[model samples]
Target: MSRLTRRRALRTLAVPALAAALALPLLAPPAQAQAGRNVRLLVGFPAGGGSDVIARLLAEKLKDELGGANVIVENKPGAGGQLAAQALKSAPADGSTFFVTHDHTVSILPLVVKTPGFDTAHDFVPVAGFATFANAWAVSGGTPAKSMAEYVAWVKNAGGGKGAVGIPAPASVPEFLVRLVAEKYKLDLVAAPYRGSAPMMADMLGNQIGAGLGSVPDFIDNHRHGKLRVVAVMGDKRQAQLPDVPTLAELGLPGFEDLPFYGVFAPAGTPRPVTDAFSAALAKVVALPDVKERLTAMGLSVGHVPGAQFGAKERAYSAAWAKVIKASGFVPQ
Candidate 1:
């Protein structure tokens, strides 16, 4: 055929090719399963703390699981995790930003703080939850105490019936635990509140504080190294990492096995599709061997609860802490 004829034929085919290309997207599934938008994982505590570490860990792998969208960790440390929790209330109700926080911000702080800045029931929606952590009542290595019984006796003998135990946050589960255990065992004890676990562990290592009630991550390594002795853990069972360690229930503190949960939540107005997508990705993220290993090593029990169950768990936990706070006469600050 002539050059002109061939050129006319090529133009005729190009029109149909473009039309087919445009129709492909209509036939394809909605891209809702993969949150292609950028994601921010907010942490309410300083970097290197347990909450921060877990946030970073899950965020690191979660982005890949959610289709390689950029996921970054933003630290908004203040008011014992209230700042970050409050930010979620105003955050865009999309998959773009979410908070990775545990019970302190979700369940406990709101009940304990006079003005916590946000309401859990209305401000946020749980997406997925897992990794319940326990607070260990640990004593310094210099003290001659290997068990809860011995630790109580040691505090009684050395400090003249007055002893202090460090807790990372003022209005937290660990702080209330100090009061409850002291009242239960009839020991003269005070709760020394710290800004975070690092400072509390520092004092514990230097023997400035005779004992501490902090999460497993704060004291696990030291306890393993003989620098500190964990008297009793408060998780569902003795940690596999420290098989010899006793759980609070096993050590005779009944009804304390179920501890706090680490969860991800979005603003209350976030769409169901977005929240569900994140939860599905997170379920896979937590099931990863490396992810589970790292979290378990840091003293978290790897598990997953869908949004509804997680929300129920949060409410139940708040109710339980409410009783403890009231019993302790802890006026909210």
Candidate 2:
């Protein structure tokens, strides 16, 4: 008990306590405010596709919001989106890597493709919904069917077998819609799958496929060039760009009214704080006037739901499409 000895002991205890406090966060889950030094956004389609476009847009804003950290997009298109889903599964559960895609790859593909590498319910956590768009049912300009009714009748009377429908991203939302159309109208429509919308449009214009099903933007230019004819859209209401085109519900198919949406997700087990950070950043980006205007120009509607609600919406979409795909007798190829 000298004063110096007592002071030395106190200093020793104080140093250890300070070190422990600093190490606590390293052991605990990451905070929502901590953006990764680098981020990678995975797109389940090739470059130049709608999903890729959206991913890049968000990546740019995320980088700006996150102190200029590099945000990059990686496209892994194949297996009806199984490739990207699998890639996501292998990514660390940290917030750095995420997958951005539509309802098809997240919900529909699992139902069609047997044993896809990941499960939406168990393998991934919803981060945020970025935008929603409608699918357009269109045909090559040379086809005899010019309208929805005409297309239905043509498929019915073409020996119930000759004509084929091209679907971008088989086992996707558009493919399921094609199946529903065939069953609802009692037509024997054969389905042909393509890697992405661009390739399918090429085939449609070449008259290799009888008709095509994909996002409206995919064929918007083709329609403008007089190489494609939009028969109907799958939105609950008519699309602004194609106001004259009726929706499936308006055309007598009320059950096909769901608007397709695109969202971002991280692999399951990602920390909740990280998910919240991502969701919040996404909300900010979607709210930006320029971002909204740009996406709207591309035929996208800007909207976002919270992470938990987005997850529920994803599950609901999965169930709804499952019924449709089953009713259409679609088996995984």
Candidate 3:
């Protein structure tokens, strides 16, 4: 064929090729296309802890809600979620990685740690706040104390007014509470810090530690089984799951009126639409009857707050803790 004829034939084939390429994206189904795509839900506590259990539950439900995305929970336990927060900071903000944590890592840590490595305001974007919960002061089988007063009395009698109280992590709200408890009772009480709630609970169950302060979810099962005794709880009101337990405010230890929160956050710079999608999916998941029932049984007041509104709540909660930390004269470590 002549050069002109060959050129004309090539142009005809190129037109069809370009049209087919343009139609490819439209032909793919959003859900099916994401079938093998992996989405990681990161928890900063060891397996069997409250945070880890919640993450696993969410991951199971989120797989279906997030358009067939293969959601998985990854535990990056250390430094009371410091390592996980740092990991989230370095993760790509393409909706692939998210941190599932409680107020301790986000609100309390920043107020207590000298340099937590990741800034909550600058390093992360709040995806959603799922629930709020109380923290409880519980006595292990090792102690004869049934209530806070008895616990105080027991501390006074034991070893000449010196005892150790176990806290899930160092420089956390429970540690601060331990200090306040010591001051209130005028005892030389030491706060023992553990990597996460699971190990702390292990020690408490084994009677290696006399007492501990942690989330209601952390102690609810054990308390119900008579493994431990929950004496005083934080927040303004008594927990529904443990109604017989008295609030700290009623016991004259009134600083922790604000309840702790549970939330999911993505790395900073994640697109708003991406976060919004996650928030919506989480809301739906939290609304499920079984999911809500499970969380409630675990000691959480299950509710879903959207991303932007949740972020505002987070800031307000952080600010409130800041005042309490200042009043306690806690130097950021």
Candidate 4:
């Protein structure tokens, strides 16, 4: 063959090859795009709070589990975790980010807020669960009430006015519980919502509020130290950490029995492989004996519900809370 003809044939083949190379970038897969990328773990509460602690704990180990990927925790900290959830919605779904939060942010918030920034069911993918947390109602150490029955009698008197109770956030499960308690026991109790459990707890310690409601983990240490008294916990049975504390059902309020959940989530459409990888790594971390001991020490249980089951769990939680919120006639603030 002539040299010029051969050269023309090679140039013709090169045209299609160059075109195909240009198209490759558009078809890039999530796995290659996410390889060795920095991961952002988010918490919707202050740095010292339990949510933040859990996120940081999982973040440190997850980094090693994910093959030494750079992982960092960012605290968004407002609106009862609404800000962090919305921020997660705005992130790229490439699998480098996740939010560690409780049922309030995922299942309860959307039911209370009329126009929440994102849909709980569609905006994020539930990746993994840490545990179910039982909310507890407690009184200040000096309040002269050590048991649920005594606490009810104390609230009934309450200086001849409605007793004030500190709740962690407005429109939260605890806030609704205040109403439920009011209706069931025929006691006048006012709900005072605060930024978070820590601040509300400060007032409880100062004796500014007779009683407070929050997650048992938030109250257990103080309760154990004699700074506060947990009267009743909101679950079917007493927690191992607070075995002496009566369950709500044990106190005759059968409706306030469901324990709230805690879990992590990635933005919607995040690659399944990426979420599954995180779930697998987390199972290992949660199974560690130290992890279980520490979690139980803080009033948490070691219940690891994986991605799909967790999503279903979150939905069922939402359905139940919707009825409670509606029945309470709470107007979101």
Candidate 5:
């Protein structure tokens, strides 16, 4: 072949090679995008709250698990975790951002909110679930009621069948339980919703509210110190941290056998490898002896549930609560 012809052929091959090189980024997943970058771990509650505490605890170890990548906890507290969920939706799905939240924002919020602004199934992918927790009904120190039966009697007599209870957020499972308690005992009990458990707990500690329903972790320390009393808990079995607290079923409140879960999620379209890597790291973190002990002490039944199984659990939990919400005739806001 002539030298000029050979040169032309090489030029032609180079054009396709250059085109393929440019297209590689667009066609393939950003598998390495999560590496060597700061990870933002978002929590939908204020600092010092249960979700925030859990996020910080996991963040500490997850940073090391990710080969020394920094994991920063960013709190976006409002609308019962709606803001954080929406933040995840708007964020870049490059695996640098993740939301750590529980069943409320993902499962129950969509069910109760007429327009939650983001759909969990459409906007997010489950990364992992670390534990399941039970919700407990607690009374303030001012209340003489130390047991479920006594608490019911106290509420029945308050203002001649009128009372108010605090909940971490509006349209939550705690609110549903409040409604159930009202119907069972025939009291005019109202649910007063707060931004998060922290504020509700503040009110409880100040004796502003006679009773509140929240996670066992939310009330465990207070219950232990006698600052408040946890009279009843939701779940089939007693929580390990509050073994003396009777199950709501044992108190004849049998509907809330299902427990809530805590899990992490990444924005939809994040590379599966990125999410899987985080999930695997989270599993190791959860299995750490100190992490397991701390979580159990905080009333969580700690276990490492993979992403797919976590997602399935979320769906089943949502379905179970749908019936309760429907029966209660709750108008979505």
Candidate 6:
């Protein structure tokens, strides 16, 4: 039994060891890339708002794809979404936590709010876009303004002098659009900032505000209920839900063409592989017929942009909104 036999056995063992090492990644339980345990989709808005609706939709689909892992939708609505942005910054970047918010939370808030917790370009990574919608200008049924032309004329020559317009949040997309409209029409349009869309809708219904600017979905049902009248949409084209309502361009105001986008984002430093997996999952979910139909029914267009494209869009939006916010003379609260 000698040195030759012992050397032959050792060489035989080494061959299998090298092969196992080479195949380690392939055999590592599929890397748990789908969902690495508990995942939370954080929304920086109230439960009943449009952002929450999108988050809940994505959470339901993500839970199914993440191997039964719990996917929770946590609402941290405050400071115009800075609370949730800060929460995302503090969360572990192990792919378990994410932020789902619209362009206002990600792009406009930081520009208007002093020290808005996290930097959009530096502290967060885009996963995928959920949906995009345009803002609509609507008046309460009690208001005499039934169309854009009427609304502008009423604001300019009405007895109230400067007509007050209710906006969901100050420095948001709707607020900016309202300002642009006022400037365009030379109307004395005073902006009234409300906490959320619900309260603003209530004010509009109660006749406390002359008009309101917000997401189209916020007022579409009410408009159908005969409580409000949509004047113009801030989109390139008319929204399908309200086909009769012309866009701002059609109404001769083309500068208010910025469409708001909603997207999923992870805390910065999340692994690239994990982000990619999440993006792929989200793309699949948005593509589902039922999901698409549900979103369409809610007056949202089913436009799912990939991670890189979404990130670029977010950056561009930030830059564009920064200029708009600065020019509008909106100081941080």
Return the top candidate by TM-score: 5
Q: How many clashes (backbone atoms < 3 Å, residues ≥3 apart in a chain or on different chains) does model 5 have?
A: 0
By TM-score, how accurate is candidate 6? 0.87
Which scores higher on TM-score, 1 or 3? Answer: 3
TM-score of each: 0.86, 0.85, 0.90, 0.87, 0.91, 0.87
Backbone clash total, candidate 6: 0
Candidate 1 global Cα RMSD: 7.3
Candidate 3 clashes between residue pairs 3 or more apart in a chain or in different chains: 114-333
* Number of clashing residue pairs, candidate 3: 1
Q: By summed lDDT, which 10 consecutive residues of candidate 2 come out lowest?
A: 25-34
Ranking by TM-score: 5, 3, 4, 6, 1, 2
Q: Write the per-residue lDDT of candidate 1 for residues 1-333, one digit (tens) a residue.
A: 999999999999999999888655333332434446688999888887788888888888987887667889999887778889888898998568899988888898888888888999999989889778887889987789998898888777887767999988887888877877887778988899887777788888998888999888878889879999988888777777778888877756676766878899999988776787788788888999999998899888889899999999889988987887787788987
Give the C-alpha lDDT of model 5: 0.90
Candidate 2 residue-wise lDDT, 142-259, digit = tens: 6788898887777667646456788877667776677678877877777788887767877888887879888986777678778889989987789887888899899777887777
Worst 10 residues of 5 by lDDT: 26-35
Q: Which scores better on TM-score, 1 or 6?
A: 6
Off by over 4 Å in 2: 1-36, 152-161, 184-186
Tens digit per residue, CA lDDT, model 6, 145-258: 889888877766774548888887777887777778878877667778876677788889999888998888678778888889998887788898998999999977776676
Model-by-model lDDT, in order? 0.83, 0.81, 0.90, 0.83, 0.90, 0.81
Evaluated at residue 88, the lDDT of candidate 4 is: 96
> Candidate 3 regions off by >4 Å?
1-35
Task: Extract clashing residue pairs from model 1.
Answer: none
The worst-scoring run of ten residues by lDDT in candidate 6 lies at: 25-34
